[model samples]
Target chain A: MADTVLEVRDLSLEYRSRRGPVKALRNVSFDLYKGETLALIGESGCGKSTMGFALIRLTPGTAKITNGNVTFVDGPNRINLMEMSENEIRRFRWTDMAMMLQAALNAYNPLIRIQDHFIDTAKAHGLNNKSEIIARARRLLTGVQLDADRVLPAYPHELSGGMRQRVLLALGLLMQPKIIILDEPTTALDILTQRSIIELLRKLKDEFNFTMIFISHDLSLAAELADRVATMYAGQIVELTDVFSAFEKPRHPYTFGLTRAVPTLHGAVEKLESIPGSPPDLVFMPSGCKFHPRCPFATDKCKEVEPKLTAYGGHQVACHNWQQVLEESQKAR
Target chain B: MALLELKHITKQFRQGKKVVTAVDDVNLAIQDKEIICLVGESGCGKTTTGKMAAGLLDQTSGQILFEGKDISKLSGPEFMAYRRSVQMVHQDPFSSLNPVRTIYQTISAPLLYHKFAKDERDARRRSIEILEMVDLTPAEEILDKFPHQLSGGQRQRVSVARALTVNPKFIVADEAVSMVDVSIRASLLNMLRRLNQELGVSFLFITHDLALAKYFAWEGRVGVMYTGRMVELSRSPSLIEKPLHPYTAALMSAIPEADPRLTRSKERIVLRSDDIPSLTKLPPGCHFHPRCPVWLEGKCDKVQPILTEMGPGHQVACHVAFDITGGGSKISAGTR
Candidate 1:
């Protein structure tokens, strides 16, 4: 088997607020195989985005990595990202793994032209030949179906939201990184623009053979893009499986609630069954399982005992009554 | 009587010496207890039309009729009454509700203003009742809590309850669920559907998300707008099943399917590299001609097409629709 492109083990992140340290993520573990797209899907405050930011060591000032390790496999060499020095991490950022942030319009410098941004990055890495760097940037733009001449001279503000996102995706691929982290890349664009951007990402992934960590609040989009899916609740990953299995046969109650909550074209016009309550407050999370407050299948044991993620049918789920829930979900289907 | 009618409405704002036509010669009829989804991309005049329907802005020409009465000339008290009957739920739940006010005050203030409730006690009771109607349990606790203490879903519920408190017949929900998480969006949509089924409230649901609109609207008519013109209006399922306009086809193709197994096969309709033409200086004819993928040789650029009935209840405004309909004759925009 090919080596894993990225491996995250026992990763926990905490945000130090005025009240106390809020455990944003707990024991989150996953692996992205080479050239595979892994989607981290969940509602807001589920720590999906937090996990993405943590992987890149770009957590906010309030957040701190409490425990865990992230290992990046570079060809035959294994690099421990968490232990890397600051300068080394900077050097590895674009060349090894790049990130396309959620807000593309804000990512670029407003005062500079698009081409200048690429020129600066290429020059910083000591690629001083201007014509060669320009050619590379143009090629990247063409790969994303953007007009090189028009986009290279326009300032970030001059471009539309869709065009700006395409430019950012082009920039992320410029270094020819092994993995690209897309954090809700199409969230800001309209439907038409979003479709184009997703198509571009799919095409680029096929051409460059890069692994992807796709994070989003929309499960349907994630289903369309990712090979495997992981569903997060509160601070932990409650379910992880292949995309088809995760959607067709979700084992966890939280996953079931989330999937049913999305309005689909194929589904009947039934009253959407929403989870009764909201997510637990991170500062004062419920005892035992953090999801017990909202889980309809919660029992006395669920309120008192935490469930570990256990393997079942080539998937991992963290629920005491996952089997019963799966059976019930199948009956409903 | 039609609940509301906008006939030949047009709006222009003067920026320096130039006039920006935001809404141009638009006509629409909204039926009672019906949900009309006005969908388009950003800056497509959907929100502006919604604002006009809610009496937030005045049309530069033509008339706005409410229940067969010309409300275009109504002012002061009459306009206030019109406004009370048509409440608006804004897009951003985070900033829409005041930070300091409790949910009770946010919802009850409208009740108090309209004198719908007898006193504070009655208003508070009604506030809690409205919260329950939106499926928000433990209404008393939520009533006393401020907006910041609630999540996006909770805040939106508060907004809906506030809109419902006035007993408005028509509600303009402009991208109401766009800001919330997807998990909560369905619940909110269900709540809206319930309200429509039970209260017989007419809705002008404006959103860029087409899937949500399809779920909530029955007999829903979709309006595809480009620039300041309505390109097409047709039944929901018919439009999605077989889109007539190129723009509609593109929009339908944009929706990401729920099943990952089915790959999207439609070729993406790539628009021109030029920016959306300025409203102040619209291209001479067919504002969409510059970006349209299948622009005809000279008809699309030289002459504009007026909205013509292609079939029963299906209207399209494009020169090519006739050619597709097996007619060679072209309709001029000026004739309309």
Candidate 2:
């Protein structure tokens, strides 16, 4: 897709807690093209947030980026994020890429005025013209449908949760980064607020044409927003495919279980089929195929042997029996 | 028989000298086998009403009748027994289930406490059976596992199993599926529907997601709440297809359709006010008048609107039901 903007290859993350090393991510690979949203979706502890944090090197002191490479192909520079020095990453971060973290309320400085926070971010990046920066900030705020006057002068506490989120979005867009990563940006908002925020993101993306790496636990929201969907389970991407294909024909059993679990807006009342077991503890993960314990379709081979992600018809699935699962799911329907 | 009936039930909590009326006078009925959905925003009082139904909180006035008996009068063991019959499945499965306890121990505790089984062995057996009913097969393996060992979805299943262990006739699932991932939410919902059909367990499925509610309940009645008041209640399909209340119509429009092709042109109803009016200092007359889109001037501020029947079984509490003056257009109940 026109020289992939960001490429994540075989990314692995580990954390050394008091208990021991917790393997949070394993061989995670994906590519973000310009002007597209790639949704990384899974349950709470499925390492989705871990991946986002790892990308920005925001993981806690206990955590470490153990393996893999993240390559950012900017205009003239092809930078390997992992290999780059701290100073290099600092320069690359706001200019080439930026992140909109979860917990928008806590992300900003409570002591500072909302507009000052934007000014600080812009100034640090060497965009010193106050009027130019202010104008840009106002335009970005307007892009998210927030009144600049009302929001700019107000303190963080004065603004609502949704407005704070819009401010975060505007701040993320201030640098005009090629790639923007959002980690569950709407998780804390109410349903209506989430709807508006998501709608705003969609509209902003269309207007700005920036590549987005959207990470969330809400599969339904992801299915709606993402061009391609990736389902993560215990440190690995289990299924990756186009949104329509993933929903219509999910190959991975874990993905199937996830889809079956989500309650739809309009349909007959149906029982949510839950995965049989919990996620494996990352500190001492299961021997092979972390999902084996919960998988209804798991066999002796599944427990004894780990499966590699295999590509077929533009979909990548890490399951021993994707063919059988696809057939069985079809038959059930 | 209807397992529980909430007749104009309201609750007001006293904070210092101020009184915060959390639940406004609202009417609802829970039949023996029907899953009634109470959908609304955060401060809508669905949880307060559920707590009242479970006898966890005392209603300010009005009646909370269980099996035609007023539960407010029930005391001590009688109240405890009433609590046993109405089980609440909370939003966070992880926090709800004790982390240190085994699945069997957690599930069997209720059965043992209520003296449902003769002995510990029987309780264990019954617990396993309930687990199996929720599709946690090879129940023996799951029995010994602690809450931390279970996945979010599995933990939620254990929560359901524990609730069912008491063999409650009515279950109040307050955002039961909200915390879990969407892929597994449908399956859990399907299991609940099965319990309703097979065991005749009535459910009060409370959530903010109207779409999820529509998919999980049958012959279901939907109540829309706004600012601690039951704004609208109607048959599920009717509520979705033709929402009578302006609030309900606005909420329906807010839902992002999964199919982007089905584009709706409805103007997004962004509530102008940031904070909900503290119940302690609520506006006069209609509680929702301050925030309502269709609110009229003196009519909404001076007079409280009773929930009048708009059609067969359809009820709405709004002073400007027929006004349709504000928000730039009129939304007739017939068009909804």
Candidate 3:
């Protein structure tokens, strides 16, 4: 069996706004194996990005990890990121883990040259040689299929959206980190550029053998790139399984609903059956199960008692009536 | 009959000392009740073309003919009638709708402006009907609620309802579902599809995603653009199955298959050094020859290819594409 690179146990996070306390993530637990791609997928505001932030201990403004242990496994040493000092975390970041955000097009400093972004990153990580940094930047830029000379001196606005995204990718690889957190890295890009970026990312992961955490609101996209998939709803992981199983034999009602809702590129055109209601507001979350309000198979029991994610035949699902949901869907079919 | 036809239309904009041709010479025709999807990247002028076709913007040169009559000089009742015949659905549901305006007011504004209703009560009743048409049910509940209170999907439905309130024969949906979430996107797309089927409304659906364009307009035609020029036009299946232009092939190759196994085993064309050409300084000859994978040495660099028909209702603009597929000797661009 492959070793676990990172383990998030009973992870709970919340943000205190003027409105109230909003639970961004609730008891989220998962294991990221070495050299594996883990996809966290859900609707917008489903806390997938929140989980990414919490894992790296960079939960944004006013957000606090109320409960949980995010342990980063390094060889034999287990580092609990939550307990690490600010200085320690800062040192650990980029060198140990790097993040390519959703709006990566705007990630670069618009006024500065692309080479300056690379050099600044390298110098921060203690690479003092200017020639070495320039050479390294050239190599990385070439790896992402960009002309090093043409792009290095150009400002962010000078490069195309695809080229700018490539610069961000090269920046993410500056330190050769063990883990890469890609939060919708290709969301705004065109399909051609998006495909090439994904291909390049997958190729880089294979070449470097680094773990990847892909956070997207697209399930089909998640299925295309990830080995394992975690379906998040509201703030909890409703289902977690391998990509094949998650797509082929989803146990949770939300997963089933999602599989039917997305339009497909291949196979017959299936009418998209949208889940009736919208995702619940985080501030005024539903009583028991957060997804209960929108779930078609929701019952009185589901409305009162929250279901914990439990393992069944190597897959984890948080649903009170998976069996009934299956039977009812089967009967309807 | 063709409801609208764009004959050799061109749009240019001035930027400092540079004059950028946002849309080059193009031709397209939208038949009554037919959905024609315009697929391209950001700078490819798909949105601008849609805006021109909707009468929201005017073309700099050439002619825009609606029902075989020029629309450029439309005045008085003709311009007012044209406005009612065409409508637009913008991309962002968040900013498109007025946050302070209730669904009723937002939908009824156009009807009230054009005097489509007898009075306020009559206007609201028709707005409710349009709301129900786009699947916003219990219309009374949504009618009074402000835009902020509704979900993204609901807001998009409201926008569609507003467009429908004018009883427009055509709609220019500019990236309409791109801002909405994936699960909600389908419902909106289906609603658009339903409108096309049931209401017989022509659509100039503009978007960057070809898969979505194909999904919504399966039976209709798709036009592929590159650097403000329509490179290929064909029925949806043919375009997806046997795309002729190199750019179309690149775009098609970029689509992520839903199946992981298929994607893993699939061979994708990752272009080498794709620097999107500037609108003001497009390269000589083919606009895409710079990044094309199978570009001809001297021919593709010097000769600008025109949109040439290769099969029934299918057209492509590339010199060596046919030769690569051994279709070079079979047929010429003019034979169709």
Candidate 4:
């Protein structure tokens, strides 16, 4: 909690669509401490991934950061990521900050051997000697529980889905950046493979003391890995707290619904109570609260006035009716 | 109560000259209005088994009896009618539902093809009622919209409605809600449960997720598949609470617990460091022996173990589980 590595304040992003501009991230703010994992969780089109892209100034297609302040505090020099020059930005990537992309298997070049990817990334970041790069890649691959002797010579297509993912993870750690961002790293993999990868990451994070921002739509996976969690709903963080607080006593109604929606490994076969109604149409968003239509506890005021994030007892929630929600939840428990 | 019986069902596909055994000799029976979940990872043959049951694909060497009659021996028109009763709901609804056709057309096609409705008006009414069953309403408004216009959840509901057009007696839903959003996934799962209870429709639900397979499903049995074989089968609650097979135990232990403190600190059953095996060229004898924790020496590697009864309505296919050599340390005390 003392050593803050990345501080994001009032980050807003937008994407240009056929209809008009779609607000993706709205006033998203959080602080990631050293060696901590902050999970950013939300449903599809909820700006979870967009926030990841915005942090490194790589917002996809037609999307632009309208306003934000992402301050990197741990490095020798304190710098705002957005205000940095293009030349400075290139050096910051993979040197100061690196990202393990979602569905990273498809991002690999099919034609090239897997070793070339590490060699090229090292060369780009000023690790010039081929032997030095190869040796490091071998060590990192071993760390990720992959055989470098077999994987380095194989093409991306030749490797299985799990192997490809491990290689991508190894590449993410090649530079040993201060902060590593993982976006849906375990998705689409088998449960066993996903478990191993999660374990491996946790082990590596403890040893290296690198700050990680894990982004996923899967709240369960996020809960397994993250120290703190920020639940995003329709372009805004609805609740931000430690994992236990978020799961046991969700301040926001949306967060509560999400927590109960998932079917855990061991529990009574309780009927999953789905949140009715889909996410609001971004282009023609409804009045006041974005989640009002789906919120079970929505009042007239909720529809008329948007509530700002307020801190109460260590948790931050953007709900006008957190008191009643907490009381009712506690009573149920 | 048993409605459909699979007797020694084995399905193989020809890839050039080599034959790939997709589904091995397996026997399963689905009761009327019963929900049976086939849970496994990719290449585990759950999907292949589901496809074979739905008549979308055929078995290479076995018989599938629908309502006490061999399905393959049915007459052409009778088989066509059988196809209507055994419907399939695929994972990707967008691809399953014709993109060019409206929601109404897509649903009514099955009804019309089976001659369930006398005229176009009758087909439309039946299709609309089916849509209403799936909770796609104002059903009349979305009737004219194409698959492209509908959201992933809505389209999935439409596919379910299409399957129910002929009032099918059984449904084979292969990862039906796996591709949809989590917010809407529970609703689809509820719909399937509703259909089972209200309309007396049996389901062979196929999914890679063991947890998802048990959603709204406590009364049914779960079959755990591994490398073209059903490794374990047990009552849903019992399977999860006390998994006997090494593969099932490993798979269950790998699940990320909902709570954070337990997730971080729980003693998990981590398997040995080995890649998921190739389905065609599987490991000898016991398919999971190479990665299993309770692996035996010569017995496990030399001879494949058959499904042995470990308890009432529970079966496991692992040599170490049953103590083939009658070792006192084996798991006889834990068997129910």
Q: Which of candidates 1 and 2 is the stronger one according to DockQ?
A: 1
Question: Which residue segments of model 1 deviate by more than 4 Å?
Answer: A266-270, B263-281, B291-295, B325-336
TM-score of the candidate numbered 2?
A: 0.86
Worst 10 residues of 2 chain B by lDDT: B327-336
Candidate 3, superposed: residue stretches over 4 Å from native: A324-333, B270-273, B321-336
Off by over 4 Å in 4: B324-336
Model 3: per-residue Cα lDDT over A229-303, one tens digit each: 999998999999999878777788888887777665555556778787788889998888788888877899989
Compose the digit string of candidate 2's lDDT tens values, residues B1-336: 568999988898888988887888888888888888998888778889888877777888999888888887876887787788898888899799888889888988888888987799998888888899998878999999999877777888898888888788999998998887665666788888889899999999998888887877647888888778888887887777667676777677667644323323334665544345666677888777776666788898898887877767777777666454331135433132
* Winner by DockQ: 4
Chain A alone, TM-score per model? 0.97, 0.97, 0.96, 0.97
Model 4: pairs clashing at backbone N, Cα or C within 3 Å = none
Model 2 in CAPRI terms: which quality? acceptable
The per-residue C-alpha lDDT of model 3 at residue B306 equals: 88
Worst 10 residues of 1 chain B by lDDT: B327-336
TM for every model, in the order presented, reads 0.94, 0.86, 0.94, 0.96
A56 Cα displacement, candidate 3 (Å): 1.4
Q: Sort all candidates by DockQ, best to worst.
A: 4, 3, 1, 2
Give per-residue CA lDDT, model 4, range A128-192, as digits (tens): 99999999999999998888999999999888778888899889888889988888898889888
lDDT of 4 at B155: 93
lDDT for B137 (candidate 2) = 77
